[model samples]
Target chain A: MSDAASVQAVRATVGDSEFDRDTAPTRRAPGVYDIDLSAGWTILGAVNGGYLLAVLGRALADALPHGDPFTISAHYLTASKPGPAVVRTDVVRTGRTLSTGQASLFQYDDEGHEVERIRVLASYGDLDTLPDDVRTAAEPPAFPPMEHCFGPEDGPAPAAGTSAIADRLMLKLDPSTLGWALGAPSGKGEMRSWFGLADGRDADPFSLLLAVDALPPTAFEIGLSGWVPTVELTVHVRCRPAPGPLRVSITTRNLAGGFLEEDAEVWDSADRLVAQSRQLARVRLG
Target chain B: MSDAASVQAVRATVGDSEFDRDTAPTRRAPGVYDIDLSAGWTILGAVNGGYLLAVLGRALADALPHGDPFTISAHYLTASKPGPAVVRTDVVRTGRTLSTGQASLFQYDDEGHEVERIRVLASYGDLDTLPDDVRTAAEPPAFPPMEHCFGPEDGPAPAAGTSAIADRLMLKLDPSTLGWALGAPSGKGEMRSWFGLADGRDADPFSLLLAVDALPPTAFEIGLSGWVPTVELTVHVRCRPAPGPLRVSITTRNLAGGFLEEDAEVWDSADRLVAQSRQLARVRLG
Candidate 1:
């Protein structure tokens, strides 16, 4: 491709949207922000839950002076859309070691009335001050080295289709688990991958949110497909990730009464468990 | 002990305070209730996280038309005290399968001002309609039968002491993980126990909340002691548990700078994964 064509292709890959939400500010209000969600931060129909949390995190970081969010649990009341939305923050408590706050993202209806969409409860603290306890029983459940995982750069064009959010994130999944993307699921109820931010912004709490739910719905690997909408999601940041790629492992152990549960654990390249999260989702079938 | 004394002991074991919480309503108001959280609910000068969640669950159930909560993620912004506190709930959404709401528990100070202590986001869901999908890849980690595990009922009586929450709940732990109570702390970073509502109330969503955080902090098994207050907790109820005991497995995968992570999995008597939860806590040291 020519230099000019290559530049155009790069823009197309990023979908003219954004991955580093830290840079997506459009209009700033006193305690609210009209942030640009861009068009590419989604999968299928709804916006990606993690990417949404990152947006909330950026707005939250500005609202609280303690530090960036070290813990954020987001409840997806409804599916959010791309484009400009309002982020309104409210400080709940300011403790000696931690600060608690809540942020809501909404967009105005055609009638100019605000419609609330996502709600997040965030806790901010000094990540650098965390203890150096090296004793833990968890390591990102073992996976093959990154060289073997098939990602967008080294693999064939996506067979299940890719969206704007896909461009900003690099999730090179273990081949065996990506069978479902080709309409052939391994039937094991697991999704494993090597994940990271596309622009090397260095993994932080914001990316941790998206990374937690970034794995394709584990249901897709267990014979259930289509949009799997999450009703609720909670992410626990164990530590500020040691700047590097994250190992992702998400598995669904139960699919009862049309509802399923996904448990995710993220480990940074340093072999430390940086973040872990779980979500309750409903399986939408044909 | 005489038969009369034994009967009194049994009643004491069940404690006047509740673990199931369905029958523990003491005071009431419109979309609000003053629940009895007895002083016995604390570990070391602070209320247990699960008990706090149950208080929120009661208020949420009354606020929404839905039957109960299957998805309740609680954030412990402050250390709540036990007493006749008020539970105030606000409805966020009313969907067909679920209803979303937030509840805050408050107690008046000597000056008579309502002070908010804990905040909960509850997603009310009907347990009856859940699909009975038993096919799961996760199971209660292997453990000896209840008869083999130790409890306050058997072995050496609890040394760290018991609370009202403890009176209503029986935790016969897998012997391997209970070494810490004796001050030995096998140092395995694991705490496994066979848990249940001692009064035979049948395990429901509220009780499940108590059960998830019921396990003695896994950090105890790793040589860390004292208060260890939970900063945040998120619980996912997979399905209605069978009418019997629950097996709980809580393990800590990381403990850094004054903070630790606890992952809990609860399985019912039928060997079904009934609920799962994770939390971020501060390690209170001597």
Candidate 2:
């Protein structure tokens, strides 16, 4: 079993449903393995454009269904990488619970090509309601939950061991919505927290994209400064969040000079927007 | 000279270009256009994902530049429509100065079948500066200078006529060494800023993408809340910003339950990281 003991026995039977092992990251053409860029779930030191958009959304939720709810409506970042990077996905169509996909990532020098390319389309609705031409029914946006939020300290740390589904659904956060705070300022230099997954957990979609790729910096509750890390992140999942205290709102629309862009919506506590994310950062001035 | 009299004689010789010729919303293909989602530009009306990402970045700067300093790097949005939406673009390579293209927009439902699909990948670089090793040496983020920021009033009531390259590039707002407050938020959902041109104006890449697609909400400037207009927007330039105040950032990552995604990043104040954009929004809940 050596590929590092089958990558440590497939990272110790990850999120076991009796060990599924696909670790999905496919892509037969267009450069190859567009998703390694130094592996997933890092924080301050960087790596967490939602952990490579939940590893291109766990390869589009391993081809859909188990009560499909996915969300991450759109994303883009054609190119930008000085060091490491990789990502790969492709489904195009799986149908039934709903499927359609495409992902390509690559970055490792001499102008490492294809920075990102996507075309996701997934469906499998449930929390129902809200489609009559959706013109603001208002309601969502209350806040304060998740044991009052507080997580994320500094850079590449999470590689310990967790999985009874990443310890019953990863990336917790709810010290009151991880202490809500983040108007914007996080070009990748780092910080992340608007996280999700707690109570009776059900996260799924790669554990709700590893709980928003392991939160810690909603720019540290809005103090702001400099640092850009998300070289690229794209999410589109439409539903999935049985976990708990997930209210996330964070925003940073644009950041000139250094180059930045941020967006998050994630809601489930009856606010319902469910999934949406976008990122591409590269600012870091210490 | 009839086309609303050449758009009213180019808005009487660009007296503060804010030109608005929109009314033409209804082409399903062949150059394509259809985002009218019922004219909701200001109060975040329902379909304006930054005006369909400035009409797919003015159909990719009318398929590659010529005069202006074309900018825009990222954008994402997969679908959205209240009345109907669609766009189409493709050039991929033009090259006189530099050009490359791709634009795919499809939003239908009058029994047309497909509901949403947008794809974009545009590049037109080559003004020089061919070094790269992922630059951005540092120093940016100051916050305060959108000629004295204030917006949130949700502008839009003025505009008698404009667009001589947006009456010569007017949008403003700068300062984000990572402090976060970018610009173009005079209220009304997702809008953005940091524009150029003006002084002796002479733009082309579709008038610098209609002046950053007429700077305005792509979505989420701190919960201004849903609209999800743009169905597609993709850009990538990297150089050219001769004018001034070229520092912009925009965000609105995902919205799921209502369908959404947004992006923008343009820098040049020495902070480098020139252009990037992504869009694909479908939310409608006004």
Candidate 3:
């Protein structure tokens, strides 16, 4: 096929949202897909873990019969770069209420061998039919209005070649938690932020996957620096998100042995819990 | 082979502790093994999810070169009963720092069909070599002395066949969280307990898997009752536990559409964070 025809084939499967277009997966086989890692989604010269999760999630959602990802757990094996990649999915089980599966993202190396970047196990369900009885003991984090928060353009410019993701994601940090970016650190081990797509796309279940890990590592507030690489991340999509910027809060409860565990909760503009995640990462302190 | 000889072969592989013997997996092939699900570790007539995770963790640990499980995420597909089961492990990646793998627990039906009960993805590492730098912002829950807490024998007798696990694990609950059992729900969505093996085996990295999920569903304190089935659970083993009853606290922050998310933290007797877990379960409030 010609280059134009190939590009058209890929665009045909893309969804309406910018996130959808960027994370769109084109079916290559019965359970395999070809995806493009957008150049704008990198952090510290590597693709963001959460964006990679969404890319894998898109393939898992398409390969299975379900329409929504209920839970996704991914382990990052190696850093991935922008360009073409392959997603191979294996459906582990299909049930009436949920479907379980695994997807591995791979990038070819110099020797033309597939090198795995991430492996994920996820379960997908139809969220529209979920029961709506709400009982919440956790309240959304109180943050200043979006206008008062320090947004992407308001904060000190990130070091060059470090935060390309900021161009794709419009993140507004809680003023109190912004100390780490400056010379002072809060030592509180927590962070709160407003998360949204820079292209004005509303947060959805797939995008919430990105929003959960969108903020800077909570360890930054506790006086840790350098690139914190996520070893494992698990996100549970509780509800469909409302069409507005998400309220995100992350806390680092424990940091030991040069490792830390970060827990994150994302609430929709409607003040409902939409997603929750926990990740294990290495704290690179020089 | 004679029944006596078959039993001897299995006994040869069992470890020193009761937990080890109960969760031991006899290698069946390169990546497959046979495990006997002990009848004593049941809640609501089904095998405890955490116990089952340990069963899988054992197999994954044995299959890999690592000595400890760093993180384990499991998706419970169906109710697992106490009987003979099979564990199949697949190593996804082997790194110097961590080895990633997946394990699936399966049981046979009367018709001889293998049914998968739990699916797990985990990473194994050597905790001994982990850096000793410590920085923690989370503190252990302040409960009265262990003697003052409600031990298994002190609480109202659990319904027959409801909590067989209590017989195998000595769980002491904070008096305040025991209202759910005495006909007065706390409505606080939190539960704190001291966890230890009734058999007197000290908690290790393997058994810490069970300690994380051993607590009752935090939803029980918020006026929900019935067998809460865990849909997904992720446990991160932070550090090796000291030789004593581990302090555990679980809190349910959000419950919507009959679904809830529970976060648990386990601290060693020395007041060091040892393990942390989060689970998504269905709240059966009839």
Which numbered prediction scores highest in lDDT against the true structure? 3
RMSD of each: 3.6, 21.4, 5.4
Native-to-model Cα distance after best TM-score fit, residue A140 in candidate 2, in Å: 36
lDDT of 1 by residue, A1-286 (tens): 7997676455322213346543344447766877866677778657788888878887887788776676787778877877678899888788777988888889777898877788888788877776675667665687888888886666563523567667777788988898887778888889999997666556777778889888778988887767888888877777788867889899887776777888888888888788778888888643
For B1-286, candidate 1 gives per-residue lDDT tens digits of 8997676455322324345443354446667777766676776657777877877886788789896787887778766777767887788888898888888888778898987788888788898876565556775699899999987767574633555556657889888898886778988879899887666556777778889988788888989876778888888887778877788899887776677778888989888788888888888644
lDDT of 3 at B154: 78
Off by over 4 Å in 3: A1-14, A159-162, B1-14, B159-162
- Shift in Å, residue B140, candidate 2: 5.9
| Highest DockQ model number | 3
Docking quality class, candidate 2 = incorrect
lDDT tens per residue, model 3, A136-188 = 88788888898878865774745433678887777888889988878688998
True contacts kept of each: 0.70, 0.08, 0.76
Position B252, candidate 2: lDDT: 53
The pairs that clash in candidate 3 are A131-B257
Per-residue lDDT tens digits for candidate 2, residues B156-274, read 42222322223334455432221124333333233445565434343323333434445544444434433435433444444454434565566553444455555555666566555
DockQ of 1: 0.65
Candidate 2 C-alpha lDDT tens digits along A1-286: 5575564343233354321222345554542443344322333334444444555555555444423434343333333322345555444434443344544445544475443433233333233443533323234555544444443332222322421233323343444333333333223322334454323333455545445435544444333444445533444455555544565555553344343445555666556565555554444433
Q: Assign candidate 1 its CAPRI class.
A: medium
